[model samples]
Target: MPADPEPTAAAAANAAESDGAFASPTPELWQALGWAPDDNQRAQFLALQQQLREWNGRLNLTRLVEEADFWIAQVVDSLWPLLPLLRERPEAPLRCIDVGTGGGFPGLAVAIALPNARLTLVDSVGRKTQAVQAMAEALGLAERVELRCERVELTGRQKRCRGQFDLALARAVAAAPVVAEYLVPLLASGGEALLYRGQWSDDDQAELDRALALLKARVSRREQRELPAGRGLRTALTLQPVAPCPAQYPRAVGVPAKLPLGA
Candidate 1:
């Protein structure tokens, strides 16, 4: 991946003038994470917002186009769960896949923050993938990002993608068990899967445990953080492969979502 572009005069002005909810987070949030965006990263984030706004009218990519909403719900929400890895090895050359990456939330935001990481953004919808591809190129991230407009189940079955990524992420994609099936098959041994959920309950964990048993994986960590401004609680569950996932996993194109593991 290439180095981030230098912040232009216009970008600096925009960042400096922004106020209220539109403004970047106070230093405390980023400080707690042990990472902060430099001028170049800030510029890339602004560019990403602009791209989402421009395409959203036609693509209906996301409703959170307002500056404040985008910053909190999209940008911050995406990066917060990554605190551990970002603080531990900020420059690791990680291979990551975002399954069902509608409008490329965490995937595109991640590419901006982690310059050394390569990303594969997958969504079943072709239009969404195409829009995300354009956004990646506009942000000068095309070189490091690959777009796959196919169902994640198929992606997990493909030789080039199966057991290929150091990290797999899925946010608001499906039920925990279904998501486990989708993500576990794509992780290389020793790799981790992060599931971003809005609300996690004991019932959810129990179902996921049953699913992981079939996948030869186990939950490695679970953490929850309250989004700023009371947007709600967010839970991130990390799963590590105990053994190779069975080949039958990820079932058929719609099976995981329809029937789900542990169902």
Candidate 2:
């Protein structure tokens, strides 16, 4: 990917102003997640917000640009699901993959917070991947982050990628069943797939159960929490593969989302 241009004076000033505007959320997020970002990590989060703002105009990366919305909806929402893992193995050299990592949300946030995690962020759009790569480099996380510009279905099937990650994550990617199909095949033994959703229902659980049966996975944990300031309800579902996912999993590049496993 090409390098991003050096920030002009106005851009630098804008970023600094943006940083100040969003600065107050750091403590709020720390309290909400029960996890604190060190000085460097906090800086990285600010940089991420700046990058999102800079790129959104050209790439339409995300809609959550306001300070509170970005902090609560993107940063907090991404990291909230990983609290248990963060607490259990804060320094582990975790191998993680973020499927459909548009604008590199939880993936970038995860990399910053964990410090030791190696993240493979996959997205089908070349422009989005390139933007994320630039953002990762700007944050000094490029060394530990890998960007793949391809469909996640293909990534899950590749020998080097399949069954290789300690954690697989998909947020608002698709229906529960489709997200399960996209994530479960990429996990190593004992690895977990964390699905981030909003307003999950009993019908959603039923569909996910049927999908897991086909994927040879089981829900190991489920947690629902209200986003701070009443943004909305969020659900995090962790699925563990009970057996090797059949080689046929993930269907095809567009099939999982179109047909949706167990539909």
Candidate 3:
């Protein structure tokens, strides 16, 4: 018989916790996604979870707060894009944005998951942005993590923010076309957007394609997966910018949602 494989980071952490002051690591969580968080990363992740739970009262932050749901929806879903990005472009440093980051699902989670990936979490809601800002500072990520309380359209208009991101993400935010509209603008040339959806449709695809063309982006890849423990179905559509988004893009606040370019 073959010898046993070495222990996973979580397994090692658990072993250490029983032996010394090592804290429990959410190994199984990252393991499901083929990534492992070290002791320090795990500590930060745990702290982020606690803060999310505590702020849930006013922020109404996450619907996936139950233990299993939290791990699958918030943790795994947030970092799923990172693995693909790292695998595809191993050497690129990340400058990311989470559009319409209500309660900072993937934005805040991504900051904790990939500490080196600088993140800007954008939300139109003041309360949500304020809460995330406080949490970022409390977690000692104030410098690397920024919270913007404004419409996504406005951010795209600002010279300082536009075209500065390597990656952009929006989860459960809006229809695909609208999301592409909001994201494609903030991305640097060659940047990519990850649109997380619960369902995919031809109509959605057509609309997104039409919308992205206007914005100089295109859907380059799509992945579908069902979360573990019957959490439910999910998909991530990756859009690559062929060129820069026209200055006209992102339109105005409420336009993308109401008129919905492609759709």
Candidate 4:
């Protein structure tokens, strides 16, 4: 009989706490993501997680506090859907903006996995941005990243960031239609936006469908996969802008959250 295959990094990490070495989040998970961090990177990741845990006790930064969840759900899972983009632009210097990056999902993990890419993490809440800044520093990524504490709709007028990013990413921030309105304008022409949706179904496609017609955006790829958490499925809805958004989109503060476009 054929021997069993080696366990994947995710499988190994979730093996069992009793297994010691293979259990919990480890550098091996990063290695599996094709980002075989050196000693420094390994240390940085560990330090960031510890600090996040510390801060979470006070601020409730994230619901994922366990080590295994941090590694698989936050780190490994976030980067999995983004591998296609990284591969296509392996040598290209790209700028990515993660909007409403609460506790920094794809933003922080993407920065760690793709050191060459410049990341701008934006959140309106001061405390969230503060945590993001601290996390970036803890990971020794201060130089490679930028943090913004501002509303997404108000950011369009800023010369430094207006239409500056090559890609935009958001997770569970808002409905796809609203998120498209918020992020598509930030992307350079021909660039793409990635929206993460958890409760995706034939019904959920309504949001994407509405955005495409109204926001001059089109879905390039709809990737669906189960998160390492095993509790829910994630859909990476990739949207490309075919034309500039009407100036009226994104409305004003609290508007997008209250009433998504095409709703």
Q: Per-residue lDDT of 28-137 in model 4, one digit per residue for the tens? A: 55555554555765666677688789878878989875666677667766777787655675556789999989998779878876768889999998998898898888
Candidate 3 residue lDDT tens string, 1-263: 12223335665455334321112235555555667766776777778777888888776877766566566667777777667654454445589899888767888777766667888898988988988898888788898898888888899899888999888899888888888888888888777889998767777778888988898888888877655444455777888999878888889888988998855
Question: What count of clashes does model 1 give?
Answer: 0
Q: What's the lDDT for residue 196 in model 1? A: 96
User: Per-residue lDDT for 66-151 in model 2, tens only?
Assistant: 77678878888999888877788889999999999998978999999899999999999999999999999999999999999999
Per-residue lDDT of model 1, residues 1-263, tens digit only? 12223445655555444434434545644553346888888789888988998999898999987755787788888999898777788789999999989999899999988989999999989999999999999999999999999988899999999999999999898889999999999998789999999777778889999999999999988877756544556888899999999989979888888897887
Off by over 4 Å in 3: 1-26, 86-92
The residue-level lDDT of candidate 3 at 172 comes to: 86
TM-score of each prediction: 0.89, 0.89, 0.85, 0.84
Tell me how far candidate 2 lies from the true structure as C-alpha RMSD in angstroms.
Answer: 9.8
Per-model C-alpha lDDT, please?
Answer: 0.85, 0.86, 0.76, 0.74
Which number leads on lDDT? 2
- Candidate 2: where are CA atoms >4 Å away? 1-23
